[model samples]
Target chain A: MDTWFYIADLAGVAVFAIAGTLLAFRKQMDGFGVIVLASVTAVGGGTTRDLILDVPVFWLHDATYFAVIAAAAGVTILWLRLKAYIPLNRLLLADALGIAFFTVLGTEKALNTGVSPVVAIILGTMTAVFGGMLRDVLARDIPMVLKSELYATTCIAGAIIYVALSSWSQTVAMLAAMTVTLVMRFGAIRYGWSLTVFKEHK
Target chain B: MDTWFYIADLAGVAVFAIAGTLLAFRKQMDGFGVIVLASVTAVGGGTTRDLILDVPVFWLHDATYFAVIAAAAGVTILWLRLKAYIPLNRLLLADALGIAFFTVLGTEKALNTGVSPVVAIILGTMTAVFGGMLRDVLARDIPMVLKSELYATTCIAGAIIYVALSSWSQTVAMLAAMTVTLVMRFGAIRYGWSLTVFKEHK
Candidate 1:
């Protein structure tokens, strides 16, 4: 189970790096900017979680995560000219998957850190969303989370499910939580679903 | 002294809002983007400081900060047409002053939160620099702090001086810290002084 979680983390890192490269490339950012985006996207979520927990940053403690992101950056650099050949939709799917995995990872980490359940839920949601927030801000897009959307809602739901199901096997809990997140998010994207809480003052 | 501090905070909020508007408006951001930038510039530093200290977010509890940023955003919306007459250099100076005050304020808050001195200094410097980081990332500029500039170093030096003299009267400590930060930053800008640590390895 631990091995599977580690693999999921590395996969998420790679996907996030790819997303960052795509954003930087779309913005015509230079090589340094590409690397910066990749690093920030890959490690940004974990770093926020660690800082909130007052722990040594996981990437700082373990060289492997940093190495993977750097290698991903190198790949983006080498493939820069051929980037147009890549499938944008596929990359978008990977980005969504990364967000889903991160929601679970962040929730579990917060629980382990002994943070209160409610704060843990908020932190989990933040952990899943903030990297993309940084990316959109850098890309000059209105941050996607602020729109009438179901982004953080998915993470929050997953966190709640995790807390409720922790009495089960850890693997079962993780699977159920992640399934809930992916289903909710993909459903929102597929059907043009949205939350319209803001009403006209008139 | 409390009144003066609040006045200074209001001044900082105004300067930061204009600066944020400049960056966002250059990208042709819509009203929502404008508001997000204004809110982030005004409250991001303190929110970050509270998160690091594991404190309830102050802005959420007190509506004053939120109101000030909102009012500043309204002013920015009206002033966008007059932007051509606005002096960018003067705005930059005002922005630097905002950063200086945030640094001291963050340091003092962290000390009160019972964090260690070293961590407090780092938090102080982050509070000083992160608004600009958000601004630049949203503006798609390579962050100013990543340059060889003395931006955060001013905050760092001032934080050390602040910690050294923190036992003195709070007003005296604040005045000394602000003086050091302002003078150091001004000298750096005037002489194009920069930290040696950022010299590239190539």
Candidate 2:
């Protein structure tokens, strides 16, 4: 179980790092900036979660995460010159999968730490969204999560479902939660679904 | 001594909350958004500090901080309606003082936790500036701290001074550090002191 979690966590990191690196390229940030953004997007959410839980930060205890982020950034720089061949939706699809994995993993970690189910769900959503938000903020763009989107909502739904299905087998519960999150994200993208914004006062 | 630290911390919170509330008003955010920005600016730095140090979050143990932020936000909202009468520099002045207090206080706290002086100084700077960074990010603006400015440098300078002066009386060391930070911030505003940015590649 631990080994599976570790693999999923690293996969999520790589996806986030690629997304962040791509954003840096779009923003025309320098090489140093690209590496910084990639590292932050790959690990920022988990760092926040561990800090809130008053535990040693996961990445600080291990060097593998840094190496993975560096490799992802290197690949992204190479890919930037050949951008015409890549479809934009490929990054979005990878991001959706990354969010799903992070949401389930965060919820499970919070539950194991004995927080209330409500707080656990919220933490899971935060863990899934904060990295992307930080990446956008550093790129000087409005965070996609806070704008008109179903992004965070999907994470919230998955986290709640995970908590509710805790009585079932751990493996089954995790898979179900990830599937729900991924479906919601893909559905939103495919159908252009978005949350309604409050009308501004005249 | 503890009482003095507590008082300084609350003062910092109130000042940051007011600054955040005013920014929200400028951004034309709704009431709920104003409250969130105020709360984050008031406590975000401290929360980051505690998380890094593996300590229980300060606000989680005390309700007073939240009440203070609420009060500060209410005052700012009322002040917004009477905006023309208020001097434009009031918020900047308050923020300067808040940064100074938070820098010294955070440095002291880090030192108490047995971290090396260099790490303690870095933590202090993080405690002083992260709140404002979070506020700007939430408002969808580039953080002023990361831009051409003397903002974080002032905090870093004060933190270093505080650590160096630790052998002196605690009260003396804290006061000296705060005074230095406040002077640097005021001088920067008065003289338009800013860090030079490296020119972007053409």
The model with the greatest DockQ is: 2
Candidate 1 residue lDDT tens string, B1-202:
6677677766666667767765665555543446556666766676787886888665433446656776776776666654434455655686778888888888887888888999989998887788877767655677777763788889999888888788787778788988999888888777887768555687
- Runs in model 1 lying further than 4 Å from the true structure: A74-83, A200-202, B1-43, B50-202
lDDT of each: 0.73, 0.82
Residues B36-150, model 2: lDDT tens digits: 5787788899999988897787765466887799898887777666552335487678789889999998999999999999999999999999999898887887786887378
Which stretch of 10 consecutive residues in model 2 chain B shows the poorest summed lDDT?
B79-88
Candidates in order, interface RMSD in Å: 8.0, 5.6
Cα lDDT for residue A128, candidate 1:
78
Per-residue CA lDDT of candidate 2, range A28-147, in tens?
Answer: 787599999998888988888877866678888799999999998898788877763446687678778888989988888888887777668767877888788788777877666655
Poorest stretch of ten by lDDT in candidate 1 chain A: A193-202
TM-scores of the models, in the order given: 0.58, 0.63
The segments of candidate 2 whose C-alpha lies over 4 angstroms from its true place after superposition are A29-33, A70-80, A83-88, A187-192, B1-39, B52-54, B59-129, B137-202
Q: iRMS value of model 1?
A: 8.0
